[model samples]
Target: MFYEIVTSPCYGTVEKVAIDKDSRIYEWEPLFAIKNMNGELEVIKMGCSGEVQSLEVEAGDKVIPGMVLAYIQEDILIGGSD
Candidate 1:
């Protein structure tokens, strides 16, 4: 298994945090709801299947593109490589 870092895709205020530390997550699962500078809401999704290692942001926090949001312990399949 490998570690993956989830990042913010835009400048915004974090409206909601959908997962907690140590929670299991899957690819494309909604992770955060952010209200951008334009007031448009955006859902942030996980990029891979994993257990969340830690969270770097919380509700009401301001975030910018490329900001680290969480660290995930990525899942690894046996025999077949990712």
Candidate 2:
């Protein structure tokens, strides 16, 4: 029923992509691995269970905090909606 965009938690360069577009991912699933400025791998996690709509960044791409990496589509059950 809504979309959730996954973002980088800190300034870093995208090191790896663990998921692809149209991929179904669960809560806390790793979306990407980023190498921080201090040379650390930070694994970004999905906050909700949904289907990946798109990937906005690729491996070796620079990123900053709040930079969107991918979009997730999650269905919200309404009150007896048709």
Q: What TM-score does structure 2 among the candidates reach?
A: 0.89
Best by lDDT: 1
Q: Where does model 1 exceed 4 Å of error?
A: 80-82
lDDT tens per residue, model 2, 1-82: 6999899999999999999899899888888999999999999996688898999999999999999999899756568756
Per-residue alpha-carbon lDDT of candidate 1 for residues 1-82, written as tens digits (9 for 90 to 100): 6999999999999999999999999999999999999999999997689999999999999999999999999998779666
Worst 10 residues of 1 by lDDT: 73-82
Q: List residue ranges in candidate 2 displaced over 4 A.
A: 77-82
Lowest lDDT block of 10, candidate 2: 73-82
Query: What is each predicted model's overall lDDT from 0 to 1?
Result: 0.95, 0.91
